[model samples]
Target: MGDIALTTLGQDIMARLDEAARFSEPGPGVTRFFLTPEHRQVADLVRRWMEEAGLAVHMDAAGTVVGRLEGPAPDAPTLIVGSHVDTVREGGKYDGMLGVVMPIVCAQEIRRSGTALPYALEIVAFGDEEGARFPTTLIGSRALSGLFDPATLDLADRAGVTLGQAFADFGLDPAGIPALKRDPEKTLGYVEVHIEQGPVLEAEDLPVGVVTAITGIERHTVAFTGKASHAGTTPMETRRDALAGAAQAIAAVERIARETDDLVGTVGSILMEPNVINVIPARCELGVELRSPERGIRETARRTVLESCEEIARARGLGFEHTLGYEEDGAACSPRIVAALKEAVEADGYRPRELFSGAGHDGLAMSALTDIGMLFVRCRDGLSHHPDEHIAEEDADAGARVLLSFLTRFGTPRP
Candidate 1:
């Protein structure tokens, strides 16, 4: 693609994204959630775009929209590219929507140019990634990965409507969800184009980067219990204050992260008893989360942090306990796909940069279905899930051209 054509392609994609943003509820920012009327309209609009691009389109039982383009050869494994279409409470336009439109435009260009491909192509727009509607997230992609738990259908939204009911309202059968999983033998791999959602690419002055891995995450709760006493009566040297022990643990958490490389630990929430300032706090509960691309590093950091907390509690004469709430193992990008994406970016006349994804994405769930690869375009100031989130037109052009080149040269299987 020429420079002028690339700009035009980017402009078209941005315009489409702007159109999608219009379906949001009346609010400060985009607030479209899964199973809402807004989601239905947006899915229809995306399906229309896919049809216009000369692909067969359908909305799966999970409300995920997919478009298919067949290759010349029969029985060839299909190449899959996609991202989620659902948004957070006030998400920006480029977060998940960009990935969907980028490939649609590229597939349209390939159709117009009559280009040949080594395999079939499928573009997917996943629904329900943000968990904006229900207590669960990633329902669409997880279903594709055979990770969807059927019990989640019993879960209800704020309106008390069950997921199964929502499916019925959308004219889909809940029983069909299990069949949405694609066979690995007939699939090539999955590719996603997403905003960096962080400052790494912008700081490095690169428009795009190859995703090395989606960082694994572990969350645990730490609670300390001590005898409550009158603040005025308790002496500083004699009191066993749980809040004081928790304070030390929180500080250690920060220091632990600062001392470690590529590791982030956060104590996002704290709840302590004895609301009155006149009384010493008897118990304190904290929510801690740790993330890192390397499992061993993350696990080690987690153990050290927890052990430090326990030691602080023992020193303060407080009962200490912790429980691992949830854990998701990290998913490394396929070496083959990573090399191809890096090569694609290098072909676009810039240095290829590699980084790990700090945020969760559909790619993490889809990794179970097939080999996964991701390309990240830089967002301004690392802002995402906010109205101010943005990417430059030139950056979009770079991402588009790189992806265009990637799809064009993906590979040919031997007869």
Candidate 2:
């Protein structure tokens, strides 16, 4: 595509992104979760765009909206491209939206050129990747990979609605989820385009990069229990405060993360029983999360953090409990797809840089089903999941050009 054409396509993508932002809930920033009314509206809009691009569109039982453009041969394997459409509460506009919009624009541009590749192309707008509404992430892609647990159907949201009930409310049959699974034999690979949620690309002064692997994640809920005491009457040395133990644990998490290379841990949430200025808390609940690119290192960090929490509680004379909530192994990009992405980036007149993704993406789950590759577009200050997240039109254009280049040259079958 010519520079002028690329510019026009970039503008179109931005316009569509703005349109999708309108479907968000009432807030200072965007917030659209799984199977909600906002999700349905976004799905309908994407389906229309897919149709206009001359691709056949369908919504699977998992609420994934897929747009298919068949290859010349009917039995040829397919190359899937897409990202999640769901957003975190008060999230930025470009995080997942760019991935979905850029691919649709690529497909439309390819169709206009009247060219067909050896493999079919499919664009998927995943229904739930944030897990903002529910507690589980990658619900859409995991279902496609046949990794979704049936027990999750019974999981309920804050509104007391089960996932199965949510599916029914959305006019989808939960029993049909099995049929949505893709055959690995028939899939070439999965490619995702997304904004770099960190500052590395910007620091390197690069607009695009190839992702090497996604970080592994482990989450837990920790509780510290202690006897309540009068805040004014209790002597400082005699107090066995649950909140004090929790504060030490939180500090330990930060200290560990800072000491370990490529390891990041967070104590994102904390709750205290009898949360008052005048009362010493009887109990404290905390949410702990750890992520690292290396599985062994991540596990070690988790263990260390848990051990520190226990020590803090024991020293403070408080009871402690740690319960594992969720875990996902880090996923490495396929070497074959990585080579293709590097070539695409080089062909686009920029030196290809390889980096690890700090945040989780649909590609992490899809890697179990097919080889996965990711193209990262630089965002301002490496910021994402916030209203301030941003990407320049030139950067978006560069990303689209790379995707077009990759599609044009990718012809080898999955071995």
> lDDT by residue for model 1 over 1-415, one digit each (tens)?
2343555778878888899999898887788888889999899999999998899999999999999999777887889998988899888999899999999989988988899888899999998888889999989898888888999999999999999999899888879989988899988899999999999999999999999999999999999998899889889988989998999999999999889988889999999997578888899999999999899989899989988998999899999999999999889999999999998898889899999999988888889989999999999999999988899888887899899999988874424
By TM-score, who's the top model here? 1
Model 1 scores worst on lDDT over the 10 consecutive residues at 1-10
lDDT top scorer: 2
Alpha-carbon error at 211 in model 1, in Å?
0.5
- lDDT score for candidate 1 against the true structure: 0.90
Q: Once superposed on the true structure, which residue ranges of model 2 sit more than 4 Å away at CA?
A: 1-7, 222-245, 272-285, 309-321, 413-415
